[model samples]
Target: MTDRDAGTAEASARPGPGTDPDPLLRIEGLRKSYGDEEVLRGVDMALDRQDVEVIIGPSGSGKSTLLRCVNRLTEFRGGDVFLDGESVLAMDENDLRRRVGMVFQDINLFAHLTARENVTLGLRRVLGMDREAADDRAMAHLKRVGLAPQSESYPAELSGGQKQRVGIARALAMDPDLLLFDEPTSALDPELVGEVLGVMSDLADGGMTMLVVTHEMGFARRAATTLTFLDEGRIVERGPPDRLFEAPERDRTAEFLRRLTDLSEDRDR
Candidate 1:
């Protein structure tokens, strides 16, 4: 096995805190594979309501895959995911998705639609709201993300950060039980990253239950109630961001954080 793989395997075997009897989101022994290569291996975690969990790991460490699997964007080979005690695997795909919204790494707004229209689409089609009501709901969410002025603009007319804010508004308009952010600011220019992270910080402060896959340590430190480190598809360490950042319990976690710090420093130079 690779060094990372060996370290993760050993770390994963360590006992963790006892599981809550009633977690808002529960993941048990989650596993996923692509052909012969496994991407997730016996993962387990639980989040209570209003928990903002930030997942950090190197590229190819299964951070994004785990988020996609939670929303059922990708099918898993084993284990179960639960939302509010309902089995996600057993729930209807449409129903499951309504409770779990995802904001992707890339801004996936509809090119032909205006920002307001993009936010209203799910409300109108999924929630079966009339145009007038959907428009009002869309406007409120857009305003929440500080995009009220860009409501009439199309995706191409908006900046990268603006498009991502619209994406966040669209997801929030759904009133989802939990939101998954998959490296939401990774595609933005460094200057634009702060705007999107600002919106996310507000959401966390507002008690939104979120699972975010990101390398943005600033946001994690500021907003994450819990920060998790995944490596070789296993959670090597997880705890409060203050604790994890100040003093990670494992060698692998410390090494990974150091690497990320070096990369961030290099980018700023």
Candidate 2:
């Protein structure tokens, strides 16, 4: 099963301050490789409670692979991924998946299933929730992402924007602690990107702990608490969005950001 199929629920949601202190998710010295070609090399990251971190980089930079490693979708060569103090790499698949959720670039909804059905699958199958309870929570999440009315529609019947919303709804139904997004809007048409990102923006605003790997630099700046850049499986630069995007310290980052932003501006005009 993929990391998208979350089979466990660790901590439902985070309690506010004065309740307790726990990092929603943590990663340490995570490494992954295919044979001798290493993709992720000892990446360490820490997100404060409720903080959203965005990772920006070029294609084949291991950004997607890094997110994949977190949910144990891709078995890494070393290191640990923890959500609410539970070790994902060492836990049972169901247990690890339940706490970690991912939204792919292609919005991998079940083609034959209705939007509501897609969202309810995890809750009913993994969590063993009854149809009524699963649908009740699924519909609420669908509505939260502004897709309640399209609940009965199949993936093919919906627009790219709508399909991705259903993907988000499907992931959220499990009530994961850490949400890993691998370019949620990358496959959509330009016009459809905004609707999907709007949902993401709302999620960030609502305090969902998110770690996103995206080429959508504007979205990174808008929705991230911290921004990270990677190249050839190594983190090159990281900082607050404004500082990182506008005044990247590393020359590689400055060059990459310049090219990326210039292309974005050209496309917009």
Candidate 3:
């Protein structure tokens, strides 16, 4: 059974805030530092099942760090992260990663591997699936992301958007309960950004739980259930997408959104 199946009972039964049970993801008093500089300061957040949570912030604001922490790509100094009512620190790294998949800003595909091979590698090596089983699963996920035709192509043969889509397919093949996107489109050219965003929007619509750090206000406005503004490693504002865009509770949030909007407009024009 998938790790997601193992956690179903706990996820549905654990009590927490609101009328619902505990969220699918919960981070409390999270703190992280690099050398003498602290990157995340007592950060706290939660994401319920099927919730599309978008985080926006200026560069160096600890957005990526938070994603890294969630999957234990980087360890935090304080606070705890819980997934399906189980502490992240207590879970095996492999097990935690299986339940929480990540798509990074960099499309880190193997240059020598075909798109299908790249997607199947994890399944074969980590999940212990045979070549045929792995290939079948990989192709299914590739089709889901609209990349089944490019399955035989190597990373060098694919465009930026296609490579990122492969990354998404690879993540999805794991059957993760939650997906984390760290600036997934930031590295793509403006013309190529839409395709990747379209796939992500589709995932959100299909009830895939996602935590995304992105500058794409359009996607945030259209797909996000909650919009969080992070600045200097702290959550300055968070609310429904419409509320944050139309009337942010904090001046900082308003100004940041205005600047981001202006930048997006300038790019379009």
User: Each candidate's TM vs. the true structure?
Assistant: 0.93, 0.90, 0.92
Model 3 local distance difference test score: 0.88
Q: List model 1 lDDT by residue over 1-269, tens digit each.
A: 35445434543453442245788899887899999999998677888888999999888889998998898999998989988998888998888898899999997999999999999999999999999999999999999999999999999999999999999999999999999999999999999999999999999999999999999888998999888899888888877788888998788889988888887778878
Full ranking by TM-score: 1, 3, 2
Q: Write the per-residue lDDT of candidate 2 for residues 70-160, one digit (tens) a residue.
A: 8878888788877777677668977778777889998899999999999999999999999999989989999999989999999999999
lDDT of model 1, residue 64? 90
Which prediction has the highest lDDT against the true structure? 1
Candidate 2 yields a Cα-based lDDT of 0.80
Worst 10 residues of 3 by lDDT: 1-10
Q: Would you list the C-alpha lDDT of every candidate in the order shown?
A: 0.89, 0.80, 0.88
The C-alpha local distance difference test score for the whole of candidate 1 amounts to 0.89
lDDT of 3 at 175: 88
Using lDDT as the yardstick, the better of models 1 and 2 is 1
Ranking by lDDT: 1, 3, 2
